[model samples]
Target: MRAAGIPQGTLAAGQERSAGIEAPRGMEEDSGRVKISDIRVKHIDRELDPPFDAAWDPVPRTSFEATLVFVETDTGLTGVGSGDTMAGFAAHAHHFIGEDPLRMVRHVETIESINFHAGRFWPLEVALWDIVGQACGQSVATLFGGTAERLPVYASCGDLKSPDARAESAIALRAEGFRAMKIRIDPRRADEGVAAVRAVRDAVGSDLDIMVDLNQAWRPAGDITRSIDVPAARLIAERLLELDVLWLEEPLKGDDRQGLVDLRRSTGMRVAGGEMAQTFADSLALLQADAYDVYQSDVVLAAGMHRSRQLAELARMRNRSFTPHTWSNGIGLLANLHVAAGVGAGPYLEYPYDPPGWTPERRDFMLAEPLRIDGDGCLPVPQAPGLGIVLDPELR
Candidate 1:
């Protein structure tokens, strides 16, 4: 297989059609042919007892849980994916019940028809891609035209506590082999955000790359009460630049295209956003306007593997950087990792590493083996067919 980022044509010419391995028991016909005879989508709710922190907003404290959507083909092969929702992903499943899991783009568009949808259905789409890749006996990355076997990863910590706590966390993550790290900021006080960065910088020294997430995109009704205005975000970006921050993420609302463009012009630090956006059109608009130095798209949130791949390709055609957001559980991380591995030049994959809440074990609670960062702070792009993740039967 050709390395990721190589032209798709190059990979296609040498791509392995199928491993020639037998399909799972139920998926093969009496003639021994493999075909998708059925599609079943189900939601698995795994709870996070304590809600993750978003200090700027006083939203109700709730459990952290994932609505896992499993696609089971008639052949007995299964592909797994996870979605994000406060009440769980029940509403999103209504649109995916009997659709072809392999026709991912069409599946996503069908689900997008639901009003109030946030593109969470993309996880289901990702699972389908996983299934299709497995059926074809190729890795998901290869399916996306990638041949690379590994990708860089960075630590992403949520919860805004004292600067010292943030600094200590950064140090620990560095010791654990993360070359880069990100910290969430208090949207109400730009100065406090700067101080947090300064403390981490001081603790980790200048060599470690740092990024700050403003999370201004999805301000719930409660956060609206304490949201920072555009001027305040601009000032914060300026200070972040002074601190030598590698990038400033989502300082403006997701839809404030003009504000993002202005912020990029006002600050030297690279500006990043788009995790909350749901379509290729939104990502294209952001890129066309030069809204950010890096594009942050989440596979699960951007409506699945097909659409996220399309966005990454758009970013590449425009000579922009793309790094997927990874705040959800391990399945979400895996889904994005597959996409990033295919993209070739994406920035570090976001690895959620906050302890007491979002540790690798907790984040991957449902999986048999948690994804671990290598000593060099990179994860081997999964070579297994489909998503390359094997869920524990017990966990299921």
Candidate 2:
């Protein structure tokens, strides 16, 4: 990956696909001198036509809401990003108002400290990376360590559908060229969820890899509910293994380190999790405890790209899979895609798709155009500078 201030096409050997790229105009003039001119956060709520049944949310789902973060540089380059609510960030915007956009580490550190009193500030960091990529005339993936411009994607269904419904969706996704599909398993009735997985497997007949998400790692604030215990998780894991599940996701609470470790060891199923891990330290603790076989952290959640890159590298070194959870909005998905591309495709990237309600068009409503999936179930990483997306005027 090209470090800060490094010219394009100068990456060293074995550095994924970096080559034959010209630097942006006036790059030297702008360089590290460009400061953050402004920061804006927008909370958007768009109603979905068909209600999306999110497995974890206790309430009925109708519309989707997201907060977008934009960081504009003094040189006129703007980067776009999205994440959790930024309700507490308006007063703290001055912390980054006049800072250098290219000082990635400094910006990351500042946000890390500011997070104690602030909300999700990683979006700003993502926006800074976006600005740097735009200023350098390169895709953020190239700025990171990615060599490939496209990666295979799996259709990650968000709704808690019935066995028959899930089976039909699986067949449709397979016909659409998706190599894999993820099913959301409701812990309340995990038995039915397992049946749904079985039905999808039988219908697709091994043409696609199946992943099941328990979503047991987290819930809404002020809700201290328990989903499953170790014995119950073991039973579910056994059933999923028998049905040829590729990986079992978030099978227990985020803090159930020993439980996760034991489940992975005993069942031999790839216990995939870490999306709820908010910081590098949290992930480090999980890693130290051998908490998971696959790390599914979201780039927008806590790590962002700065710390996420490190987590991806660590996963690679430890011979573990690093597929990010991309269930958020378009910008958030794109941010995770850049990081996942940088790390190289392990199995498949998460493509949030449950049509009628959670279609790509609705999920990516803020973008100039919806990020469409190809016949081969792959998404071409945007080549345009920054996060490779121009926000819709309506959203702006």
Candidate 3:
């Protein structure tokens, strides 16, 4: 069976490219199409000089790891993407070998089934979309629908700092062109987190829109700890409301749809979650229940580009927001960007950054140039063909 939102036909036909731009030479056969020749995965590891104290992690991240996927066509054109470990995918590689890369709808169906029985291989979908964009001589965002040229960015800080330190950091971000910032609230240290939010609000006043993340959806590996009860979460929501928070993200578990709805209704604050819902079906449930004011799902992690486009549109039709959670490497983030920008979803998109720990340079070490917000604090959607990815030449 086919998943919802994916169109019925294939991208192999009725294709169009940007004006004046041309697809690579000799990329088509008698069929006027190219077949997937190979799918390769590379594991990249980079060590952090000063370990990163990620709010969600039980311990500091000493090194950064990325799984880069390369999908090559018979025409010698290759598309790249990065995300999950792609473990157990080697056994499933035969699924896409020697098939038309343009049969994206079919490929998306196959991958969705594999995801239920095997592991997540959506990055391959990202790579295939990358190939389709290059074949069309347009950016994937354009292929997805070219809705907006750029989107505003929010500094998604991952580390926890003292109230004073965090307030100082907020000031720095405001000075450096950040119009908004997200502070991760530790469930265990709810009071401390509230204090930090209060401090930042006092420091920045109304210049920057502040978002708070509860990080309660999924726990770190080996974390058997229980999530905060609804009563506790509700109390925290009340506290954050006074601080003028833009949104309270993941204040409850991903499955707590009713709790999320109730919290949003009671507290009157925008609730955002579902970043890792694992499927379009799961997210649809949340959207249907009116559980959140803003829906966030990483395209690479949960909904592939096709499904994400549909999800974003559905959210808009429902008068809800669709800003995705983009905390992965640059490629993964770009995947989210193309889909989000293509569908015009958001008042702000997540841009992971926290100085001296997680920076654009470290998050995008695989790219030739790290993506940064411009002087106006907008993340420009790459107009170049494909996802506009440029791998670092020195990165072997």
The numbered model that scores best in TM-score is 3
Higher-TM-score candidate among 2 and 3? 3
Number of backbone collisions per candidate, in order?
6, 1, 0
**Residues 22-59 of candidate 3: C-alpha lDDT, one tens digit per residue:** 43444334466698989999999899988998988888
Deviation (Å) of 9 in candidate 1: 26
TM match of model 3 to true structure: 0.91
Choose the strongest candidate by lDDT. 3
TM-score of each: 0.83, 0.90, 0.91
Q: Per-residue CA lDDT of candidate 1, range 1-396, in tens?
A: 544544455335545644343324532224444444444444455556676554544662455566666677657878777755424455555455544456555566665665245434566677778888888898888877784678878788767868888888888888888899888887676677778899999998876889888887776554454445678887887877877888888887788888888777766668888986767777778888888888887878764567777777888887788888877788888888888888774568888887765678778877889999889999887788888887767756
Ranking by TM-score: 3, 2, 1
Worst 10 residues of 1 by lDDT: 20-29
Instruction: Output the lDDT of residue 391, model 1.
Output: 77
Local error of candidate 2 at residue 306 (angstroms): 1.1
| CA-lDDT, candidates in order | 0.74, 0.84, 0.88
Clashing pairs in 2: 17-147
Q: Clashing pairs in model 1?
A: 26-75, 27-75, 48-64, 122-303, 122-304, 149-381
| Residue 39 CA displacement from its true place in model 2, Å | 1.1
